[model samples]
Target: MSDQVQRDQTLDISQSFIVQAPAGSGKTELLTQRYLKLLSVSDEPENIMAMTFTNKAVDEMTQRVLSALKSSFKPKPKEPHKQITYELASQVMQRSDEKEWQLLQNPKRLKISTIDGLYSLINNRYPLPSQLVPRQIMAENWARDNAYRYATEQVLLMIDDKQQGRAIADLLLH
Candidate 1:
């Protein structure tokens, strides 16, 4: 795709897009720009989520977005990519100022995290239905195995309860 078209698509927040490109191909830049655009138009900072595979990417993207917002307060950038970032950041900063978001003061409002982090956030916010314990996702296989074993033990213990046993049986039968 043409660069302009790709840029346009990235700025379009009305729909979602899966951006796939080789490393060092500005995918992060595009995503950061999109995130800034979303922030500019959104009232709730927590509603805007950007998920990546690794915590490293999450940190990088979060830093990039924050840096862009900070940089926007300075003079305009010379580089084309940075110029775009500055503009988007300026818009977001304007909206944030109007809404009194205080993003710079509280950057944690930005919902940029790894997929596992997002899952954990959801699990913590809305707990699982019954005696089923919510499992914390881990990157290491050993941790995952341990969590699974622990959850299984909890479920087994719950099986002794008549009501819980019936719920488990119903779930297993389905």
Candidate 2:
């Protein structure tokens, strides 16, 4: 089925869903539409959380949803599918345009982001284990830095040993 039909059919359902498709298959558009659907129904975008694999996807989905919401206030597009989605969004936002506008203005409540983004938000909001420190998000390369540090320590250990250290160090360097 086309994305439009699928979107229309699933617009009212509040159940969890997954959109699996190859690249350029409108997966992002489907996600944006579904998010819009949620906005239409609840007017509580903060209550809707969406997780994607990459930062780019998160940004794209966020932008698309915002664009759709903004355009919903303007004249409907000539494209039929666009018209339907935009009108649906218009209807949903009608009662709480100010709140929705505020949501658009501030994205913290939108909750559309990468898995890493979600994790960071949760970690910041909650206390970590006694042994663990709060971590930087993926954008800061925290994991990579830790891995590099561990590897360097291991290499240094091997270099200091006299027995198999040379062989092991040579193997690792090569």
Which numbered prediction scores highest in lDDT against the true structure?
1
Give every collision pair in model 1.
Answer: none
| Least well predicted 10-residue stretch by lDDT in candidate 1 | 130-139
Q: Rate the local accuracy (lDDT) of all candidates.
A: 0.89, 0.72
Tens digit per residue, CA lDDT, model 2, 1-174: 776666666655657666677898767776677776776666566777888889888888888777876787798799876776687667656734755446656666678888888888787866567625444454357778999999888877777688868887788789
Task: Kindly provide the TM-score of model 1 when superposed on the true structure, using C-alpha atoms.
Answer: 0.73
lDDT of 1 at 93: 93
Write down the lDDT that model 1 would get. 0.89
Instruction: Write one digit per residue (lDDT tens) for candidate 1, span 132-173.
Output: 444433236568798999998898788769879989777778
Each model's Cα RMSD: 12.4, 13.1
What would the TM-scores of all predictions be? 0.73, 0.63
